[model samples]
Target: MMKSKSKILVLDDDPNIVEVIVTRLESMDFNVHGFTDPGKALDALRKDSYCVLVTDQKMPEMDGMVVLREAKKIDPDVEVIILTAYGSIEGAVRAIKEGAYDYISKPFEPLELVTKIEKAIEKRELKQRVRFLEQEVGDSIEYRIYAESPAMKRTLAIARQVSDSDSTVLIQGESGTGKELIARMIHYESRRKRRKFVVMDCGATPPSLIESELFGYVRGAFTGAIKDKRGIIEEADMGTLFLDEIGNISPEMQTRLLRVLESGEFRRVGELKPKQVDIRVLAATNADLEAKVEDGSFRPDLYYRLKVISIKLPSLRERKEDIPGLVQIFLSEFSRKTGKKIMGIDKRAMNMLFNHQWPGNVRELKNIIESAVVLCKGTTIGPDEILLSGIREQKEENLNTLESQEKNLVIQALKKANWVQKDAAAILGISRRVINYKIKKYNIRPEKVN
Candidate 1:
């Protein structure tokens, strides 16, 4: 059985040109629709979904640029190619600036046209795949933790397996390693998903308020207690309670928390009656609880209770291979939020990203990408647009190296010249040929500007 071909729409004022394009596309296994009248071709576009559109620059009712605009309005993802005669090159360039996929000169070779079309289709497919990934992450009920590395995948698989049980989960990782995100994922995927998921940061709260904050308080329980109030634990009854930075709680609070975990019983401040509630606990910490236990800072019994099912998330450096995917997701997100048309990142910028040690982990990477998207003035991100002052400061010894210094100089020149290689060379007091050589040597590929 033969698979159906992708649909393509072709429009031109000359019937001969339209016939030639249609015949060539159809011979290459594309489902092609040809029309001499612009109105009819646009009508077809409005009625049917097409993978690509090939239109002539000049027409009676509409120009190719108008066709491109209308086609995009109908389907922003559709790839449009403009056909222009030799004298109408400017019009073709304008069409490209207005979002046409690519422009082909009239009297173009059949093979050349086919090759461009194939490339355009490939780009469209890539965009579709990125969109699918973004949708998958956005729609997930579990917290949005994007990862393509096997270590993180294995950790998530274990998380899914243990989510159905009421076992206390201890997520251990470095700061910004998304421990809190994992806690949320466990809560949403567990049986208590429908119930409230209350969060209490053990590290941020003061030692004096930890007890009263975890357990409810009665009127006159403390100087500020004017009325009865429920705490996070009571609010999380029949639900999940997430304790972030669990290693930071004092010894007394640990003992109290251990009792709650053991018997599901706790008493509000200034109250004698014991309150019982059914709740699951999820704890996370960037500190070494085992070391703390040995030092008598954290209780051994409490540590054991929290580690019933431990999950250790890999740091961003451990999963560097996932940076490209994460960058794409972040670029799309920031673009939509900021209303920027930033398409993608250049190869040189991506290499810099991969080389940097992300001490702040995924959180740091997301912030960097957001800043780049906001600062980027072109359709794509180049190395000059990426701001990594902290990372550079940490690697100050490497700054004096020839390659590093040269790379910095080249990035500065490119930024000042708006990425025009000729102008960038002039600004750097070098020949265009030398600049091109350095660009290739340093693997600096700036995004194309229309």
Candidate 2:
């Protein structure tokens, strides 16, 4: 298709050359568009994205130099390769000066041209990856390292210790407790750090879509499957796959995933042939898999297979000692993000944050700080800038009101369920997702009730 990432635009005045090049690249799994006219090739460049431009130096309309310049304007990232006459140093040098990636001499081996195109693709990807990593660092490196509390220190220690192992790890915690962060820490510290660390939020993804997303599908796997597709598992073949909300998946889906864990081989959707992968799996869930297994909603065998090692993250309220450190880190982080010179939080705001129930945990704290930084007119954030239906407002409201009653009801159910969200949801006749949302909404916890 025109929008495919691996598409190549091949332009040669000679129809035979275009045909040969297109056939070769197509055989190697590239989506290629061949054009004999310089005008038509330029039009195609405007129409779709292409990874490389392979163009002829000698043309009646315009030379490869002109085509290269035009292609660069269309897509600055497009790598260009000029087709030059044998021993034509002038043309090659001109092409390079004009920003062509490389030049291929006429009558060159098809394999040689393929080799250069591969390198051009590699160079382009390297540049894009560096840019992506820069953005990630700017966004998250701020609060990722704060371990001021003993609970947090213990959690991080377990993560670091398991970085050297290849066993499956089950991370248990409440939502917004940075389970993915811990998983990322394990992956980036491991031997496969250079490879991809693929993540899938199993709870957010629908049961109907889970199969094809995890194992991928071969061409003609189903009616709408136009081409072979790589799933999240395939993308993380040599590295790690972090499945969040693992307990939310269906019984049938769990069996399929268990196959991948027990054996490295898995069959893609509608494909008979089994493919193998080498990957360490790390699964996280706020839901209690032990409770689910007891109820027969989650398979016991699959649960055991995934929990070779386990780490439980404490809620923000349990580790309130880290609040100030976390707030300062977030202040600096959001200051950089919003281009604000915010210096600090006032004592009242800091006190409010410290005393808040923090039902949404560290993630809630980060969001509140980001919001405050945006609203902050001066260098310091005051009490009013700390926006929430939190402790500040809770103190000002009546205990007998609907909001108060609802908060008490949630905490009562939570205590009865032993703080397991899935069990608590069952007790309240609500979905686990709903209870999770209500927890964040009302900021409910036992410590806040008294």
Candidate 3:
């Protein structure tokens, strides 16, 4: 039996014609629905999705032209085929002008109609694929970063400086520190921004398949290699390829990657000829490549090549000054996404966020905010809504030490506001009395603070 994923709608005023068309389509393994009334057909089109609309031109309630126009309105990608006993050059032209795929003459061969249906389905599928690609590009085309820290500021400055050049950049960081985010900033800010930005995770993929996945393969290159497939490297031609967890790649894969970096050429598995591609490579990892090299698990030559332009990102704890801004941004993001009205975080909750060491880093912070937003019933996110892993088990005294989150925030805000108690209070949105109390509590002596 023939196979298709297209859900076809067959509409003819005559019951016999509808039955014949539906039966033929179903026998060919097409998911077909039939309707004798134009009203019902249009209703179905409005309520459900149909890739192909087969409608009789002559109808009592509505003409096929009307159906064609309405179907297009419902789904511009829907391909309509007009069927009429009174087929004419004028009628066919009218149908085409009204957005019909094709006009069919009465008593036409079932095979001929089926062929047109198949062609229409192919066009519909092609349109969908194009739309998906366009959406992908549209969604992530911009590489703007709203970061709020000097640590990130320095990182981005380096990233922007290297974007114009085609040199390979190796970004070093603990996991969840937004290494990939920095890579995309470089890509979007570069000349090759119009092309694709393909991502491959070396740590997640098995070594046996990494070769085939990175370099692609021909049909029958191995078992289940049913068709020739272009690898990730080919897909990223004239674009950017970001290999995450680069240290996890096998030694054999490292040799192949080095060749690509040096020569700009690679061969698909089972293929004799090599395909030349121009691509800028960006690699990231939480592991230390130097240690790996020392242990002889990684290639030293490849390591040097990848480290041509190096960037080391700080862990979240090192950039604690950014927590307030990051938390507020994450709160707004998760609030909008979840349709929650949580507009702000309570001081204790914000303090809890600051207290955590954040082993998972910014990603963990974002997830925590998302969870808080989902669970928060009131407009503000309280400490009860904030579920921290280590806070509950840790003692209250440790949480409220002289070097605590609250004291640090007061100091930073004081420094930012030029040591004026009232201004610092304004910065932290607290009263002057509160700021003075905090200053005394944290032992803020002017000479020592300065």
lDDT (CA) per prediction: 0.80, 0.81, 0.81
| Candidate 2 lDDT tens digits, 174-276 | 7768898899899878886766678887876777889999988876889898856667887677679999999888888899899899998888898788877
Candidate 1 residue-wise lDDT, 1-450, digit = tens = 011336788889999988888888788788889998877887677544577888888887897788888889877888999999999898888888899999989889988888877888777767865764464357442256787899999988998899999999999997668888888788778877756678898766777888989997877888989856678898687779999989978888898899999999998898888877789999999888889988889999899999999999998889998899889988988898899999899998888888876656777677678778888999999887875322242374655554565566667667757789997766454567667877888888666312
Residue-level lDDT tens digits of model 3 in 1-450: 124546799999899999999999899989899999888887777644577999988888898888888889777889999887853658867898878888788888898899999999888766765664575456442233555678877887898899999999999997668888899888878987766788998866777889999999877889998856779998787789999999989888999999999998999998888877789999999888999999999999999999999999987888888888887887777777788887799998888878776655776676567667877889998888775211242455555642475666567667756788987776554467657877998898668867
Could you tell me how far off, in angstroms, the CA of residue 205 lies in candidate 3 after the best superposition? 0.9
Kindly report which residue stretches of model 2 are placed more than 4 angstroms away from their true locations once superposed. Answer: 1-143, 387-450
All candidates in order of TM-score, best leading: 2, 3, 1
Candidate 3: where are CA atoms >4 Å away? 1-144, 388-450
Residue-level error in angstroms, candidate 3, position 88 = 18
Candidate 2 TM-score, true structure as reference: 0.65
Off by over 4 Å in 1: 1-142, 388-450
* Residue 225 in candidate 1, Cα distance off native in Å: 0.6
